[model samples]
Target: MVRREHEGSVLEAGQALRRGEVTSVELAERALAVADELGVYITRFPEHALASARRADREFAAGVDRGPLQGIPLGVKDLIAVAEAPTTAQSTVLDWGQGIDAAVTTRVKEAGGVIVGKTSTMEFGCGVPDRAKPFPIPRNPWDTERWAGGSSSGTASGIAAGMFFAGLGSDTAGSIRMPAAFCGVTGLMPTYGRVSGAGCVPLAHTLDRIGPLARTARDCAALLEVIAEVPFVAPEFTGDLTGLRVGVVREHHFPEDADPALAGVFDETLSLAEGLGATLIEVTLPYWKELTTAVLVTASCEALAHHRAELITRWPDFGVSARGIFAAGALVSGADYVQAQRVRQVVRQELARLFDDVDVIASPVASIGAPLLDDVADEAGQQNAEVFEKITTPYWNGVGNPVLAVPMGKTGDGLPLSLQLAGRLFDEATVLRAGDALQAAR
Candidate 1:
């Protein structure tokens, strides 16, 4: 029964705990065992997780509870600090030592959630997948050989494989959304400043955001209740999408580049939206190319500043991919960086204009479906790093809008296909509501 609960939402898990249908210790051990079996957690800290769960159980036993996440187990990104646990961030540069606790962890503890383990991550939250780090490459539970799509790779894979009900992941570009897409789960990048960033390792302070990835948007919403500064009104799960509007950009935005099955699923998703009374509208953003360029320049410069000391002191300790990318940041001129910021202002203004006409915009989470682990390895030393940047996330990060990646279905080979929906500024509730409707259709 506990194992069955693993595939359900964090809300369901909490219900089981409250009903005494499952013990925290039993659930913690089950999660830890699955983490080991699925290769979801690179660092299995069962002792820490069990102890935390036990504490939570005692609190509940005494009529002290912290809300929805009480006694729930979660895996946090290695980049986020866990007190007395090694914060490796999947970097060869990090020595094996305990790290001080981060603000997010502190909040979770206070909320009565158990930190099960530190999931794997790309060094310092860069998107490239290079095995130069000490930890094993995190595997996609849906298909072990495929890439899990980012710096939050392990967190997505871990949750999808039923290792944890939900987990914390950061987005500097699409770190959170991409992995959520590739892993067949739902993830959210809440409005900027909606959650605190204290204690988590910096990626690009301006662009980085921490959010939750879970099996469903409801689950993600439950986690958001903990991290968000203000109490969130969980969307009235009116699966009815009456009078809802969905905009699709097909040419350059969502092209034939998507895997066939993914394309099909997206089309099917459109039908579902229509059936629920949504009017699908076709739309395009102006100056899309500039949006992409501005994101790169801004993100690179911000990242360079954050890691200046580390890059200089322990340059060789970084994962090869991270080091290579950070080196490019150093080369960017002050003029180019400023120009990028100006471009960002333009992009944001344009996004604001678009949202005025539509409820939400939908697109593929990635141009291509999940790549094989071997493919990521094969391209490690490849030149034209900018090419990789263009092919992946950054634009949304630059614009600072809420992007929700909801698992639509799977590809021909069984890899997941996700549709990304970007909402107006600070409109996470509408995005989650849209996702909730889509998930129910599935």
Candidate 2:
């Protein structure tokens, strides 16, 4: 039995596999063991995973390596369909028979990645922690008592806990970045439409993006190389941010009541970026608050549209938190939806203008670290977690831009704080380059 801690980034694992240091079967078994212990998986397909691993091992032995993800064991959020596994979306309302491989799942499999199982998520990718639901709540690996952010909950917690090297997560209103921030892992939400959302459940058609969460920006780059629709060449890590222009949006992102520890860490990270020769300039986003409001309205209305029939017929089956959120969408007037779209267009144009002046926009991923499970167990906690603690993520979602959340430093309690880098549309390479530089510096 080879130890699992030896496993790290997908690149490192690929190198080790090529060197005969580890087998795909060993990695899959280790991942299953850890996932079972942590309750990170909503479903486990040990047999199917081992079968895939054995095939990956054969391919590697035959010198037919697919890529960095070849032989890597990865998790998929439950909302995404994987052949033969139930796409429960961590809700009782979904039809299990509708499960089919999502486009991203097909890509991962084609790249020789082993599908471990479906991971837990917030019900339909919206809602507070609901103990009433018949699914596991993903706890932050940093502190089991703290809640992992969702609806990419299990993917983030699983990666942070070393259950797998990387996993697919959908970001709409910070599902990927928030959990990645809370769990102390790196997550990327590519520009909307860069990756297909087909076969995966949708929260908001316009806001949803499929991307990877992993240990490092390079690993995410590797994953994106496989899954992205257009050709994406990852930038080389130059170990310094020379010639990079980073716009720091401190005024809007950092509220006056934000944690002093988080602010101090963010300031230190900015200094580090400056030391790397990157020019840092403070920039105020136009109508930042209104843009954020546009995200809420658009996402809520879209979600309501998707679940209207279900909410009408299966109200009891849905989690209370999800039901309330989706139901609130019904109250949104057509005029309000159209007005929100206008705001979105305006915000997008403003961001485009802002990006014309800077290579990337930087902000804190969240205002605070992960809150305790007990603190976010109900509606009040959900409000605190979604609205107060998280401010910057949804704004990017509204503008439909690529954002990468990378760990900057830890809180006084050892929880992770992250920095978000937003890039021009379809310019994920720049955001990732900045993230890679920061991670290397750390």
Supply every candidate's count of residue pairs whose N, Cα or C atoms clash at under 3 angstroms: 0, 0
Q: Candidate 1 local accuracy as lDDT?
A: 0.79
In candidate 2, how many clashes are counted? 0
Best by TM-score: 2
N/CA/C clash count, model 1: 0
For all candidates in order, the CA lDDT equals 0.79, 0.86
Clash pairs for candidate 1:
none
Each prediction's TM-score against the native?
Answer: 0.93, 0.96
Candidate 1 off by > 4 Å: 1-5, 35-39, 95-99, 377-392
**Model 1: which ten-residue window has the lowest total lDDT?**
382-391
